[model samples]
Structure formats: structure tokens, C-alpha cells
Target: MIALKRLQILLPFVGIAVLLAVWSLTVWARIVDPVLLPSPVSTFRAMWIGMTSGKLGVDFLKTVERTIYSTAIAAIIAIPFGILLGSSEKVYRSVEFVIDFFRSTPASAMFPLFLVLFGVGDRTKISVAAFGAALVILFNVAYGVMNARKTRILAARVMGASRLRILWDVMLLESLPQTFVGLRNGVSLALVIVVVAEMFIGSTDGLGQSVFEAQQLFNMPDMYAAIFAAGALGYGLNLLFLTIERRFVHWSGK
Candidate 1:
């Protein structure tokens, strides 16, 4: 298991290294124009320059702030409602309808309305992302709660466990693994949404803005750097979540 886990972690880095090597070789060979496909070295240099100037840091922080805020809001709003609706069959049946509808709705389609309402700021971006991301989280958490072991629940009831005790000790604990999975997915969606939101609404700064601006100026190296940063940030976020899951949902490993 440890060997498999190590391989799982190493494979991605190996793949990335191979890709970068191939990219550099191709660029050096002039198989692709530098303007079109920057060399890995060039991209890395651009990234270093951006970092040294603190542009990348600022943009990275802005995106992180937005993502964190949006995710927090989504989780707060989704979790309680998910628990409430999931606890009862009737509530689940009714709310499932709403969940399906909203989950199917494209966030990009609602961007215009958000811009109009919030005037093209962080709130609009965060709200739109949260709205879309929360549905997946809500449904997953609800399913987790609903599908918690019936035997355990029955045992708890027979043992005269209070409702709160059952919720805290059984339901939440039982549902945590599923909830974390949902959160992982939600964070992925949120990252995508955030980039799109920054692009559409034109934030003061972010990876999206950096990419957009670089493209306009035809700076392929810088554009690639921005994209690299975004990819690295997204990867880091997933890593952080996986670590949390491994720590808190250790029982699920069994």
C-alpha cells in the first residue's frame, strides 16, 4: 500500500518532467516557434521574473483569497441544508429535485447576471463560483448522510443515543469520507470557475488576468508561466485536501 501510494505521488511528477523535457527539446529544435510554444527554460525564466517582481505572488494570493472565501461560503451554506434534507426521506426526495436542477445549470450562463448585480467585482466571481460548487457538495454530503450504515444508526437508536449524539458521533463521522470527496471535487470546480470568473469579469489581478494579458501582448513564455502557476496552485490545493482526508478519514483507508 505504501509503495502504491508513493508511486501514485511520483507518477505525476515524472510525467510533468517528461513533458517539460520534450517541450524544451522541441522548442530548441525549432519544431515550434518560440512565440507559439516557449521553451521550458524560457517559461521558467519568465516565471522567475514574475516571481521576483512579485506580480505572480500578488496574483496568486488574489486567486487564493477568492477561492478560499468562495469555498468557505459554499461549505457553510451547503452542509447544514444537506444534513437537514438528507436526514429525512421526504426532505431528500423534495430537495433532490432542486439539487439536480441547479447542478445542471451552467455557471457561465449566470455570469452576466452576477456582473450586473455585483458590478464585476470579487463578490460576483466568488458568489457565482460558490453557487455552482455548492450543489455538488450538498448532494454528495446528503448522499453520504443518507447512506450511512443503517445497522449503526439502529444500534445507536436502540442504545438511547440522543439525536445530537447520533448526529455528532455517527452521522458526521460516517459521512466524513464522502464529504471530503465532495469537497475535493468542489475545490476542483471552484478553481476552474475562479479562472473563468477572473477572465470574464476582469479582476485587478490573478492567474487568469496574467494569462489574458500575456496573450494580448503575445508573450507566450509569460502566458505559459501563468498557466503553470495556475496548474501548480490547483495541484497544491488537491494535495492539501488529500492530506487532510488521510489524516481525518484514516478509517476509510481500511
Candidate 2:
């Protein structure tokens, strides 16, 4: 079992190595133009230079900040609203169409609307991300609450628990696993929207800005570097949520 666990840990690294090997071979064999597809070494070099020069660092931090802000805003708005809606079928039904409509709409499509409402500033970018993330979070959180065991709720009520107490102690805890799922999805969506916003909405610094600038200049290595940075950022954020879920939602599976 220990060996199996070790293999599981090493398998991802092995897969990554194999991918890198194939990528390197393609570049070495000139299957693709180096100008369009830089070698892994060149991309790594570019990333290192960007990091050392502090450009990537600054952009990375900006992207992280925007993601955090958007996610926080989404959570703040989603949790309570989701609970309220989930607690009452009437409330959920009343706004279900609206929620589904917005959720189905592409977040990028709403960028123009947000820009019109909030202007071409961080507000617009942040708001778009928050809006998209909130819907996803709300959907998951409400489902979590609605799926809470009826028997537990009945037990609580039979013990004379107040509505608020039942909500706070029972429903909230029951929903945490699904809420974390929402949070993980929400954060990913937030990052995607933020990067797209920075790319199109005139940002001074961000991973998206770096990528856009690099592409415009035909700096393939730099663009690849920024792309890798974005991927790493996404992986890191997901890992963080997974860690938090494991710690907090201890009873989730059982």
C-alpha cells in the first residue's frame, strides 16, 4: 500500500516528464516552427528571466490578488443567498430561471456589459469574475443545502431547535462539502475570467497582459512562459482548495 501510494505520487511527475520529452523531440525534429513553438528549455529560460526581472512576479501577484478578491466577493454573496434559497423551495423556484439563464451565459460575453456598467477599470474585471463565480457557487451551495438529510433536520426540530440554529449548525455543516466543491470551481472560473479580462480590458499588469503582449510581439517563448505560469497558478489554487476541504470536511465521504 505504501508502495502504491508512492507510485501514485510519482505517476503525475512521470507523465509530465513524458510530455516534456515529446515536446522537446518535436522542437528538435523541426516538426513545428521554433518561432511558433519554442523548446521547453527556451520557455523555461524565458520564465526564469521574467521571474528574475520581477515582471512575472508582479503580474503573478496581480492575478492572484484579483482572483482572491473575486472569489471572496462571490463567496460573500453566494453562501447566505444560497442557504436562503435552498431552505425554501418557493424561493429557489422563483429565481431558478434567472439563475440558470445567467449561469448558462458565457462569462466572457458579459464582459462588455460589465465594462459598460463599471467602466474599463479593475472594477469591471473584478465584477465580471465575481458575477460568474457567484452563480457557480450559488448553484452548488444551494444543492448542498437542499440535499441535507431530512432525518437530521427533523431530529433537530424535534429537540426544539430554532430555525436559525438548525440552519447554522446542521444545514451549514452538511453543505460544506458541496460548498467547497463550489469554491474550487468558482476560484478556477474567477482566474479564467480575470485573465481574459486583463487580456482584453486594458490591464497594466497581469499574466493575461503578459501573454497578450508576448503574442502581439511574436515572442513565443515569453508567451509560453506566461501560459505555463497561468497553468501553475490554476493548479496551485485547486490544490489549496483540496487541502482546505480535506481539513475541514473530514466527514464528507463517510
Best by lDDT: 2
TM-score of each: 0.92, 0.95
Compared with the true structure, what per-residue lDDT tens digits does model 1 show for residues 11-106?
769977898788878988999866799778888999998877858878888888888888888899988877877777688997688889989988
In order, the Cα lDDT scores of the candidates are: 0.86, 0.94
* TM match of model 2 to true structure: 0.95
Error of 2 at 130 (Å): 0.3
Q: Evaluate model 1: give its TM-score.
A: 0.92
Model 2 lDDT per residue over 99-198, tens place = 9999999999998889889998999999999999999999999989989999999999999999999999999999999999999999999999999999
